[model samples]
Target chain A: MRATLMYGPGDVRVETVADPKLHEPTDAIVRVVQACVCGSDLHPYHSMDATTDGVPMGHEFIGVIEETGTEVSSLANGTLVIGTFSFQDNTCVFCRDGFQTACVNGGFFGSHDVPGAQAEYVRVPFAEGSLVPVPDVSELSDLIPSLLTLSDVYLTGYHGAHMGRVEKGTTVTVIGDGAVGLSAVLASRELGAEQIILMGRHTDRTDLGKEFGATDIVAERGDEGVAKVMDLTDGEGSHVVIEAVGHMPAYEQAYGVIRPGGIISRVGVPQYEKAPVGFGSIFGKNAAVTGGPAPVRAYIDDAIPLVLEGKINPGRVFDQSVALDQVADAYTKMDSREALKVLVKP
Target chain B: MRATLMYGPGDVRVETVADPKLHEPTDAIVRVVQACVCGSDLHPYHSMDATTDGVPMGHEFIGVIEETGTEVSSLANGTLVIGTFSFQDNTCVFCRDGFQTACVNGGFFGSHDVPGAQAEYVRVPFAEGSLVPVPDVSELSDLIPSLLTLSDVYLTGYHGAHMGRVEKGTTVTVIGDGAVGLSAVLASRELGAEQIILMGRHTDRTDLGKEFGATDIVAERGDEGVAKVMDLTDGEGSHVVIEAVGHMPAYEQAYGVIRPGGIISRVGVPQYEKAPVGFGSIFGKNAAVTGGPAPVRAYIDDAIPLVLEGKINPGRVFDQSVALDQVADAYTKMDSREALKVLVKP
Candidate 1:
């Protein structure tokens, strides 16, 4: 079997690896239809932190079930499935409360012992919990874009919006233009946000933001950007703000755009630096900020239905796709900001 | 008219001062029937910041309206009233949203040009918005206690509960057992909290807390206190926590008792320092923390009505009273913890 392995920094390679067999009864094998690089993937890509050697690299994938273990009843061989990057037991106390990522026995694919999905065939554990089988598609190509997005970006974006309580008539401000930010704009629109402000510097991404329900865009950064957002919202600021970037600037920007007693749902994966924020931003303004990692499986059931029903086309953000062998090229394109999201065919 | 004036730390004096008259159309001249030493008043008394210029010190009072300006129609001359320590227009956006303390024109009396109520007569501004008239007074003696608690402690405690979202069947934890903290136990009970945990070391306060509806008491401090609270909460923590101590340790204790997605409504004045917090505590825990100096005016109307109807008896917390001539003794007794509340008659 051919699998993509990351030996070290910038060392992504397609190599012959052992075929994965059913190691656990709850595990199933899936033939990858499409997988993609994530914005979080950039952390390891550019990080100085050493990772597990001879590691499988990608996480986001939509695939067809190739084999099922004895305990896997939900996923059948040949059924198409969109697998959440993070797996969880859906009935755990935390999962039942919509915090699946923190499930008592939950695990993140590709990071721990679980092999990732950036291969022709990959092992998927807890198939019933991780895999959501989509409807049969007449054409396989049309499935790639929607399937790719459903894995992580759409659910993560939805997490941001959901945490912020973005409802109908809400004024929303998004603080990032990456894949997750664009997905949040779409999710906010889906939630019926009357006004969506996208703050970023890139014209292409900003345009994509507008297409996904951004009524206004603030190209400035930092204090200037917050001012522009405030001006656009009649000086009261947005009722809901989706903070997709976890850095200091993004935190401040999120705080700046939320009105008193408003909400800031931050889904940005914080790295080394703790965001520097004072009482003025979080307490004095009386904003409620919430969100950690998205409970993707908690959302995939509902989000998948929306995709299968064609009610929301999150695939609009996907700009390109390439053969799985060209994963390195896709990374460069995404890293260079040349593509919003690139789908990789395996 | 004679007023209680602070010459310095432990140097309160009763002396003749110019009688206050109508200062604005929104003002009324009140003959102070009773005034009380606030928990916050002891702060300046105990601190190095203690002033010595004979400043009048009390902000909490029950009084008879002696004169009214042209625009002061809500309270007639001779009407008994419980007035908020802070004056607000009540028509500003913040006041409409029920945060009268943050009102555009809101101003604290006894601090700025507005004189303290520890006098025979003092000017009350925004009279219509400031005073809540009491119609029934069969227990006129309760007036001093009711009036004493109304302006500061009771409202502050209610503010804590309100910020914590104290509602029917919710479990609430209160950190601090000063007068306001004990008052919060009462407020939480009135709000229908199913289980209440009061953190206090003193047996007297814990007994008062239990009477005020505290189902559990944690006598330990710091981590031990948190452990005690957790032991009582079945390991999940409470749905709401009220912080009434205004110290960093209390802030930390407040956060410790609340569950993920819980609320910590702080009503303490944040005396030690600006509480150090950031996006992580808020976003990661999915908690909603909202509080400030209590908007006494926002709640005074309902509270005063309750007091007048005998539905609430904040007077139980008042341990003693004295004439304005004994202002120095009042301060000394309160500073020595000899009285929970000291009501002074003018």
Candidate 2:
């Protein structure tokens, strides 16, 4: 089986590796049909130290269940399925509360212990809870890319808007121009945000954001960006700010462009541990800060219908696609900003 | 007019100051009936630098309207009223959104410009918006203390519980057993929280907390406190943590004791400017941090009925009282922890 692996920073490769096997009664063997490079992958891509034993890569994927453990009662082999980035029992108190990412029995894929989805065959734990079975899409194969996004990015964006409580008449400012940010623009619109402001420097991405429901785009960064957003919002900031970029400046922009009593939902995996939250920042305006690893498993059921019904086309974010053998090129393209997101066919 | 003034750290004085005069068409002069020393007052009491000019020292008060400017039509002279700590023209967008503390034209009363409430007469700006008229209470004079608390402490506690979304069947952990914390216990009970855990070392205060609504009291701090709360919740942590103590340790305990997907509503005036908000803290659990100065004016209307009917007795937090000339001793008693809170009559 061919699998993606990272040897070190800027080093990505596809090499023949042993096929994943069922290790627990709750596990299922998934024959990957599609997987993608994530922006978070870029974090390790830029700074991961050299290692002789390469790290498995990728967390998002849609596949067919090749084998199921005895304890996995709800799912069957050969069924098309979407696995959330993090595998969970989905019955834990936290999972039941819509925070499957924090499930007591859950663990994220692509870690050293749990080989990743960007492989020919991947082992999914808590199969019944982590994998949502999709209807026979033999003829509706075109929906694959969109369904694949529900594994992570799309749901992450949705989590931002959902946590921020974006709704009708809300003015939402989405920070970052990446796939997640664009997805947030779409999610905000889907949630009935009256105004969508996309803060991004990339014209191509911002243009896509506009198409996705961004009524305004602020290409500026930092102070200028905040000023422009405030100007657009009539000197008051947006009612909700979706922070999709994980940088410190993006966090600053999030707090800056949020109106008094508004919410700043950050889906970006933060790059820094400390940020100002004192009287000078969120406290002064009574702003709330919320968002974390999206409980994609919790949202997958509802999101699948939206994608199946063609209400959203989150798959458009995949601007480039590559064969398994060209996985390294996929990473290079995404890392260099040549591709919004790269889909890999195994 | 006699007023309480903080000349420096450990130096409080009762001095004769010029009677407040209407400085804005929106202003109203209120003759103080009762004003209380707050937990926040201790911030300056411990660190205030010596100066030739003293800072006015109180913000909570219920009083009779001595005079009303031309624009103050909704309120009349001689009417008993409660003024929120921060004065705002409640018509502002933020005020309408239930965040009057962040109103564009709002300013706190104890600042350099606005004389504090611990005086014979205090000028309240945005009178129509800041003052909530109380029904004739001369016959029910006992309710004055409680009504005065609605201006700050009690409302601050309500803000914490409200922001934390405490409701039926929810488990709430309240940090700090100060006036605000006790108020939060009361507020949590009022909001239908099924389990209320009050975290404090003071038995006297915790007893008051229990009386207010705390079902459990944890006299521990730091890791032990976290362990105790986790143990009490069957290792799941509380559904909401109301941070009533504004220090770093309190903030740390807040994140520590919250269940995944819970809310940490901080009403404590944060003493620090930075805190960790990365994966190791709030983000890891999908916990939200929300709260700031209470928009008391927005809540005063609903709270007035509760206090008027004797359903709550927030004024019990005022454990000591002082006359206009004894205002200096009020601060000393509170500063020394000899009194939980002190009510000043001017």
In candidate 2, what are the lDDT values of residues A39-131, reduced to their tens digit?
A: 999999999998888999989999998999899888877889998999999999899898999999998988767998888889998999899
- The digit string of per-residue lDDT tens for model 1 on A245-290 reads 7676787788777776677787777552334333556555556656
lDDT of each: 0.78, 0.91
- Chain B TM-score per candidate, please: 0.93, 0.98
- Write model 1 residue lDDT over B19-131, tens digit each, in one string: 88787899988888888888777766766354656666677887888899998777778888777878788887767867677566777766537878888887888888887
- Candidate 1 docking band: acceptable
State candidate 1's TM-score: 0.87
Q: Which ten residues in a row have the lowest lDDT in candidate 2 chain B?
A: B131-140
Q: Candidate 2's fnat?
A: 0.82
Runs with alpha carbons beyond 4 Å of true place in candidate 2: none
TM-score of chain A of 1: 0.95
- Best candidate, TM-score: 2
Candidate 2, position A320, lDDT = 93
> Which pairs of residues collide in model 2?
none
